[model samples]
Target chain A: MELNIYHLYPEHLNLYGDLGNVNCLKRRCLERGIEVNVVNFTDDEKPDLNDGDIFFIGGGSDRAQQLVYKDFLQYKDVLKELIEEGRAVLAVCGGYQLLGTSFIDKQGNNIPGLSILDYESKYTGDKRIIGNIIIETTLNLEPNKLVGFENHGARTYSKYQPLGNVLVGRGNNDDDMKEGIVYKNYIGTYLHGPVLPKNPHLADHLILQALRNKYGDVESLEPLDDEIENKAYEKFIKLYGK
Target chain B: MVNVRSMIALYAGKFSKQVLKLINSSGTALPGKLALRIDNNFLDNIEEKCDTVIMVTGTNGKTTTNNLLNHVIGTRTDKILSNLKGANMIQGIATTYVNNTKDHYDYGIFEVDEGTLRSVTRYVKPDYILVSNFFRDQLDRFGEIDNLVEDVYTTIEKLPESTLILNVDDPLVNKFTQLPNKIIKFGLDLDLDEVQNSSLSMKNCPLCEGKLQYSSHVYGHFGNYECDKCGFKRPNPDFVVSNLEEKASSQMITIDYGDEELVFEYPYTGIYNAYNVLGVFTVCKQLGLSDDEIVSAMGDFSFHLGRMEEMEYKGKIIKVILTKNPIGLTQVINMISNDERSKTVVHILNDNPADGEDISWIWDAYTICEREETVLHYYCSGIRAEDIALKKKYDNVPLDKIKINDNFKEIIDTAIEDDVEIVYVLPTYTAVFETRDYIENVVKSN
Candidate 1:
C-alpha cells in the first residue's frame, strides 16, 4: 500500500527543522516496504489532500504562522474531512497552533486557526513553557508514557477537556495544562521536530495504528533491529521515568 | 589607607579566576552567573580607559581565527590581549580584562556571539572587526538569518575606520566587505571537492537581491560565487589556499600569499577548516608574521575542546563536533555522510530557551544526510529527545534503529558501545557545554 504524507507550509513555518517530521514519517513507511509519496505545500501551491494518507504540519515564526493561517483557510475543509476520516495526522509546534481555533500573536492580534483541533492557542503573558516535555496518555497502545521536547511561546487553552495529561515536560498550556489534542486518528502537539528519534515506541505506535487502519492488519510491518530503540527507552526511563 | 569595601572590590577583581574555579566545581545551575556579575563592574571601569578595541565572531571557526590572530600578534609583540578560553561575550571579555593588569592589553582579540555581537561591540568599541558567515541558527533566540546580518551591520556602522575582514563565500557576510573601509575579503576558491549545488539557504545574493551563480560551495554558504545582476563576486584573498586536498589523515592546504607560497598541513579535516586556517594566515600576514612563523604555529594548533576534538572512549574513537546551528551541523553531517563506514549519530537538542525555543531546525539537517542505510544507530538525547526522535522518524530513519534518551549518561554509554568507527555528536550551545562537562567528568573519568 502507498502512504501519502502532506507537509503544509514547509518553507515559511519550518523555522526549527519542523520538516524533520515529514522526513521521519517518510523514512519509517518506506522501510516497511510501503510506497510513500510526499506532497509539500507552501506559499501559493495547493496540494491535493485527497491523495494523502497521513498529514503533517510543523512550527515556524509568528509571522510565518500568520502566513499559514491565510493558506490554511483555503484547505480547512479538506483537512477537517481528512481528520474525520480517521486518517493519521500529526501537527507540531506552529503547525499545532495553526490547526487550533485561533492563535493570539505577540501583538495580541488573534489569527484564526484551522480549528482541526479543539484547542485555542494564544501568546501567553509569559512565553509558553519550553524545555523537555513528558506526556502520559493511553493514545499509545503501549503502557509506557509518551515523552518528547516542547518549545513554543503560544499557550493553548480549551474549555472542554484537554487532549491528555502532562506526565513530565511542559504541555499545551502555561501551567501543566493539557499537552495536545488526540481524537480519532489525529494527534497534534506542541512538540517540535526530532520527536520520534527519542521516542521510538511512540513512532512505532503511531505507525502501527496508521498501518492497522489502512491495511486492517499490521503483520506485514517488519520491525528492524531494536538495540538502539531499547537503549533509548532505558535511558528515558532512567532519566525522566518515574 | 583603603577602606574595607574598597579592598573587597579590588580583591574581587583579583580573585576572578578563583571565583570561576569555585563556580565550575560547585555544580551550580547557572555557573556563568557569578562571572557575568563580577565582569560587569570591572568592564564599567575599563571602558573609561581603553580607546580602541575589536571583536571577531561567528559559529564554527571563530575560536581558531581568534586564537591564530592572538598567537601571531603576540609573537611579534605582546601588544594584544584576548580571551583565549573561548568566552566570546560580555562576561568572558570582562573576566579576561579583570584578570589582566589594569589599563593593559592594547588590542582585544575577542570572539563575540553573533546575536550579542552588536551589543558587546557597542561597549567594547572595536576599531577592527572580522565577521565570518551568517547561517540559520538557534531559531527561538536568533529569530532568523536576516536578523543576525542586520545586527552585525548595525554594529559595523557604529565603528570608526574599523578594518572589516569578511568571508565573501556568504552573500550576507560579503556585503560587509563593501563598507567604506580597509575591507579585507577571504574565501575558498571553488575546487573539485566543493559541492556543486547550493543547499536550502544561500539561494540569492544578499547584495543585489538577484539569483546567485555559484561556482561551488565549500559547505553551507561558504563558497566561490558571483552575483548575476551586481558585479559582486568572491574576491581573491591576500592569503589563498590552492590545490587543497585531504591527505590520508591531515589536510594539505597550500597557501598562496601574493609574492610567497607556503604549504601547511592541518590535523583537522574538511575544506571548511582550510578556510579557517586561511583566515588565520591573512590575519597573521597582515600582522607581520614571517612565513616560517605562520606555518609553524598552525601545525601546533589544535581545537581546545568541543570542536572536532578527538578522543578515545571505551576503546572507540569519537569525534565531537559542536553543532549549534544548521550550517555547522550540515558541515559535520556532510563530512561523515560520504564515508562508507557505519556511523552512529547523537543529536542533543536543549530547550534552555537560550539554545532557542524552537527545535525545528533539525529538518534542514536531515535532508542533507547522505547515507541512511549505514547509520547503525541514531541517539537523540537532551530535553528534546522525543522531538529529535520524531524528526528522525519523519526523516525515514528506521524506527527501530533510532533511540531517545533524556539522560546524558545513558546516551553517551549507548553511543560509545555502538559498533561504529565514526560517532558524530551534534549538540546545541548549552548542550555543548553540558556534553563537554559529562565527557570530562563522567565519560572521560571511566
Candidate 2:
C-alpha cells in the first residue's frame, strides 16, 4: 500500500538532524516492500493532507519555532482534525512545543501552540544536557521499550499526567515528568532529529503499529542480522542501559 | 622587591603549560581558579607601549597563517606573543600576554575569535589584520556568516591604515579588499579540478542580490567568480597559488608573488591545506621572507595537535581529522572515502553545549557518499552513537556492515583490533580531544 508522509517546517525545525526522521521512515518502509510518498511543507505552502497516512514535525530554535508557529496556524484546524481521525502523527522539539497549549521563549515571549497535546513549555535557565539520554517506556500495545535521542532547552510541564515515565534522560520538565505526549495515534516529544535512526526498534514499533492497524495481524518480518543489532544494543546499554 | 602578582605573572608561562596538562588529564572545562589567578587584561596596560600589533582572525587556517607570519619575520631577538596553544578568545589572548611579557614585544602575532574579533581588536589595537574567510559555523552563537563579516569589518574600520591581508578566493574576505586600507589580496588560480565540483556556491552575491556564478569552487564558497551585473570580478591576486598537484602520498603547492615563486611540498593531503599554505606564503612574502626560508619552513612544519595529526595506535596507522562543519567533513570524506581498499572509520558525535546541543549536523556530513563495499566495518561512538549508526544505515550502508559502540574505549578497541592499514577517524571538537586523550592513554599503557 502507498503511504503519504507530511513533513512540516522543514526549514525552521531542521536545526538538528530532524530531517533524518523522514529519511529513516522512508528507508525502513521501502526496505519492507512499502512505497512511501514524502511531502515537505514549509512557510505558507499548504500540503495536500487528504491522502496523508502520517505527519511529522521536527525541532528548531526559538526564533524558528515562532516563525513556524505563524505558518502552522493557518492549518491548525486541519492538523487537529487529522490527529482526531487517528492519522499517525509525531512532533519533536519545537514541533512538540507547537503541538501543546503555549511555549514561553527564553526572552519571555509567548507563542500559541495547537493544544493537541495537553502540555505547556516554559524556557528554563538551565541550557545544557551534554551527555546521552535513554527513555524507559513500555507502550501498552508494544512489548519492546521505546528508545530515542533527546536534545533541547525548553522544559515542558503538564498539569495532566505525562505520556510516560522518564527512565534515563531528562524528560519534559526539570523534575520526573512525562518527556512527551503519546495518545491514541499521536506521539509528541522533545527528541530532535534522527530519533528514529538511533532507535530502529522505535521506528519499527511506530510503522508496525500503523501497518497492523490498517492491515490487521500481519506476520512479523525477519529481523536484521543479530550480530550487528547486538553490537548496537550493547553500545546503548553501556551508555543509557540499566 | 617584586609584588606577589608580578611573581605569579612572570611564571605564568610555566603555569599555562601545567594548566593545559591538567585540562588534558581531567577532560574538564577551563579551570576557574587558573583563569582568575592569571591577569588576562594585561594587554590594556601595554597597548601604548607596542609599536605594531597584528591580529589574524577566521574560523579555520588562522593558526597556520599566524604561525607563518611569526616564522617569516625571523626577528628572533624581538619579543613575540601568540595563541600557540589554540586559545583564540579574550581569556586565551590575556593568558598569552601574561605568559609572554617580560618586556614589551615588538610585534604581537595573535589569532582572535571571529565573534570576539571586534572587541579584542579594539582592545589589542592591531596594526595589521589578516582575515581568511567567513563560513557558516556555530549557529547558536554566531547566528549567521554576515554577522561575523560585519564584526570583522567594524573592527578593521577602527584600525589605523595598517595592512589588511585577505583571501580574494572567498567572496566575503574579497569584499574587504575594496575597503579603504593598505590591502593585499591572495588567491588560487582556478584549475580544472578546482572548478569542476562546485556544489556550495548557491548563496546570493554579497555585491549584488543576483545569483553567484563560479568559474570553480575550491571548497564551500571559496572559488573564482564574477558578478553578472556589477562587473565585480576575482582580481589578479598579489599572491597566487599555482601548479597544484596531488600524488598518492603527498601534495605539492607552489606560491607565486611578484618577483619570487616558492614551491612547498606539503605534508598534508587536501586542497584546503593548500589554501592555508597560500595564506602563509602571502603573509611570509609580505613580511620579507626569502623563498629559501619559506620553502625550508614549509617542509619542517607539522599539523597542529588536533588537526590532521597522525599517530600509531595499536600497531596501526590512524589519521584523525577534526570535523566541525559540512565543508570540513566533506574534505575528510573526499580524501579517504574514495579508496576502494577496505578501511575502518570511527565516527564520533557529542551533544556537549560547546558541541552545539543540536546533533543534527551529522546528517549533512554522513550524506557524503562512502565506498560502502570497501568500508569493512564502521564504528560510531560518542553521546550520539546510535544516532550516527542510524544515519549510516539510512544512507544505505548495510546494517550488518556497521557497529555502534557507546563506550569510546570499546569503539577504539574494535577499530584497532584488526591489522588495518589505515584507520580514518572523524570527530567533533569535543570528541577530538577526548579521542586524543583515549589514544594517548592506550599508547602509554602499551
Which candidate number has the best TM-score? 1
Model 1 per-residue lDDT tens digits across residues B1-446: 33454335445654655765766642221223344453434444344444445568765678767876776666665756677767766666665655556455556677887877766765666666777777776655654566578777877887757787777777788788767878777766654544432224564566654556767666665667788878787777765666687763478877776787777786777656776777777766655568888777777666655777766776666767777666666667777776667778888877565676555566576423677788888888887676567556555677787777777668987787888877777777678766876766655578
TM per model? 0.76, 0.75
Error of 1 at B315 (Å): 12
The CA-based lDDT of model 2 is what? Answer: 0.68
Candidate 2 falls in which docking quality class?
incorrect
In angstroms, give how far residue B53 of model 1 lies from its true place. Answer: 2.7
Interface RMSD of 1: 4.9
Per-residue alpha-carbon lDDT of candidate 2 for residues B28-143, written as tens digits (9 for 90 to 100): 22332244356444446435445567778877767666765676554433577676656676667766655555566666778887887876765667777888877555554554
Q: What lDDT score is found at residue B127 in candidate 1? A: 64
For model 1, report DockQ: 0.24
**Model 1 lDDT at residue B338:** 62
Best by DockQ: 1
What number of clashing residue pairs does each candidate have, in the order they appear? 33, 5
For model 2, chain A alone compared with the true chain A gives a TM-score of 0.86
